[model samples]
Target: MRGLASASVADQLIDVVSRIAVRDLATLRRYFPALSPDEIADKLVVGTARATEAVGAGVGTAAALPTPPAMPAELAAGVLGAATVECKLIAELHVVYGLRAPGNVRQRAALYLAEWTEGRA
Candidate 1:
């Protein structure tokens, strides 16, 4: 069922985001020592935009190729990819601002998901 697929996707995304490594302050500093916060944010925004677009394009391509029954799976994959990319962007922006959430990974991930949901609403 569609509902089942959606719930599975949400659970998997929560697990993935909670575990995925986002750049920390020190990591960002090492890689972008010369960049200002604004510059870092611009980079993050650009990268996120590209990744989101890629996910959209992937879904579009799959829709053009797959049978109707396969279309839903491709749709779900698109949703998952977009959410993961957006969550990573949110986490990176928090780092750029020197305000990465202070909690265990799961708690921090929940905050990012909440932010994502809020933005969608």
Candidate 2:
């Protein structure tokens, strides 16, 4: 029963991560037409989901994550790198190009992924 409960929780978490990733990628693609859809989805969306999902969400928004517990180091690195890319895209879109919503989503995803990877929950 405990195992099943944990599995269910994990599943729910995955769902949330998926939703955020897909939405964020769609927004990102609008600004950067040069990037392939697959590339945006994999490196940005799924990466955010995996990294954030790993961290759990116990930590508040202001706190920095303390290294993910269950996640492999390589995966964590990939997520952070992706976050950097996302951040750059968002900065260009909002600061220079004046696209706001995408910028917001990307920023939020960055925070969520960092928190998730830190394993606060």
lDDT of 1 by residue, 40-103 (tens): 8888889999999999998999899848999878987897788889999999999889888878
Q: Where is model 2 poorest over a 10-residue stretch in terms of lDDT? A: 55-64
**Clashing residue pairs, candidate 1?**
none
**Which candidate comes out best when scored by lDDT?**
1
- The list of candidate 1 runs beyond 4 A from truth reads 1-7
User: Which stretches in model 2 have alpha-carbon errors above 4 Å?
Assistant: 24-27, 36-121
Q: Rate the local accuracy (lDDT) of all candidates.
A: 0.87, 0.45
lDDT tens digits by residue: candidate 2, 2-114: 99965664454433433443333446667556776455544554554564555434222213446556345444444444444444433333332333333355354544444
lDDT of 2: 0.45
Determine the backbone clash count of candidate 1: 0
Estimate candidate 1's alpha-carbon lDDT, on a 0 to 1 scale.
Answer: 0.87
Q: Residue 48 of model 1: what lDDT?
A: 91
